[model samples]
Target: MDSLTQFTLGAAVSALCLGKKLGPRKSALLGGILGTVPDLDVFLPFDNPVDAFVLHRGWTHSFFIHALATPVVGEILVRSIGALRESRARVWLTVFLCFTTHAIIDAMTVYGTRIFWPFDPDPVGVGSIFIIDPLYTVPLLIVVIWAFFSANWTSRFQSWLVAALIFSTSYMGLSIALQAHVENRAETIFADAGIDARNVFAIAGPFNTIVWKVIGQEDDRYHNLYISLFDEDDEQARVYTHPTRSDLTACLEGNDAFEKLRWFSRGYFGTALQGGKVVISDLRMGLTPSYVFRFAVAEYAAGNVRSIPPQAIEGQLTSLSDDLNWLADRFVGQPSVRAAEASGGEPYGTTETASCVERQTSG
Candidate 1:
């Protein structure tokens, strides 16, 4: 989720917990600031991009860290605000709500969260909602702002605030339900195509949940689909074969850097030989033709393999202009077939050669 949504959420929660005692305005301000504190780990130093990616939402976003920090921050609030000096416990609760809600909401996104932290560094994600959705934030923001302006924390005002929170939370439930529906659709599509899908993952489209993107991974290929819930006809599936490897993985089987990337992607990756280089592309992000996380893990020579330092590689672009336009169409519950094709919609891994691992065969 974006920082604005997190800030508004924190503000709303704090107002609910301590609005009356600390005044609505003060409570909102305090909560909004504290809510954004957990994300400050982005400034922490890291040796490499892989570490940076994996370390994000680690210790700082952990529930344990927030829990421990709550009392400390609450004490500062208690001392700073004369009105709440006597209400120490309520102040702590207020801080706790804001801080913890940030982690909880982040866990709902596709990137997942390490909210449990030291217990396990595995990212816990629902994979239901996209990082940004106006439907989730706009309505809640309206009500939160209204609550902030109200002079008193009257029962009616509190009811309105709680109702807003309920609506937003329920939207998350809807996202999950829609994801299940999409998975079933994907399975049926794969079945009809006579493709055995080893794994299938569904994610909501860019900004809205009405459109879903499904990826079905197989041993030799992957099927991708963009389905609009409001579409009048069944969506067509696009098939893309995995790039062929010439004993690349067999040679660098246990290379350290590649192993780390393998773990990070949970094995959802594509391999290609570009310029005689073996690159592993993280399939979780970016569309198939243009992925965001490709790394050159090894170099191939004649029949030998040598492990090299991992280097970030960029995906090939079909056309930037058409890609943006087709993306916009999908966001609005409609897709243009011509635009899709022009925008690298031919199938997955089409451009994943030359600059990708299959480059060795290129002229």
Candidate 2:
């Protein structure tokens, strides 16, 4: 989830737990600040962009860390803040709830989070929601804004706050259910097509979960299938192929950072030659052709593969403008049938088959 969502969720959590005692204004402000503290790990230095990308949601977002910090933060607040001194235990409880809610909400997104920290450093992801969804954030933002402006009427704000939380939580559950339905359908479709793929997932596309990008992984290749809730039951998926490579497998396999990235992506990544460099792509995001999280993890020089510190070029890992319109159309404006028909039955973001473009090649 985006930072704004976390901030607003924290505000709701804080206000719900402390609004009656501390008033809405103080609770909202305090909660919003604490909500973002966990994400400050972004400033931590890393050897390369790949490393930073892989470990972005590590121990800092862990529930274990938040649980340990709660007492310290709570005690400091209880002593320093005059309003909270009388109710030390309640203020501590408020801090724990608001802080932990930030990390828990993060775990619900496709981007993984290390909620367990040292016990389990691997990111725990539900894949139930997109990283940023207006449906989940807008309602909570309204409640937070209302609390900030209005001084009194804490009880009334509390009612609306609870309502917004229920709605957002319910939406997350609905996304999970939709994912299951799409995966089951995708499984049947693959069987009919004779694609011997066992591990498959229906990932939400861009803004909404209704339109899913189903991926099936074999040994050295992945199959892409696009399905939408709006289309007829008989609508066939537009399948795309992406080939995996081991061009410099020996070197990349030995690198600790590369292994971490592989684990982070759940092995749904591949190598590509981009601008005469060994580039890695996280296949989960963007469309088939134009992916967002490309990184120049190594350089190829003099017909030899040389390991270089991974670097991400612009318009790859962080660009949103390129896919914004497509996401909007796929999610709301255009019907899925039109998109399937408009492509003339060809998979979008593909060149011939994935095999030709992504075949194994030497430097």
Question: In the order shown, what is each candidate's alpha-carbon RMSD?
Answer: 4.6, 4.7
Worst 10 residues of 2 by lDDT: 350-359
Over 4 Å off, model 2:
248-251, 301-304, 315-363
| Model 2, span 82-154: residue lDDT tens | 8788988888887888777788878877678899989987887777678888888899999999989877755
Clashing pairs for model 1 are: 272-357, 273-357, 273-358, 273-359, 274-356, 274-357
What TM-score goes with each of the models? Answer: 0.85, 0.86
Clashing pairs in 2: 289-349, 292-316
Give the 10-residue window scoring lowest on summed lDDT in candidate 1. 354-363
Q: Give me the candidate number with maximum TM-score.
A: 2
Best by lDDT: 1
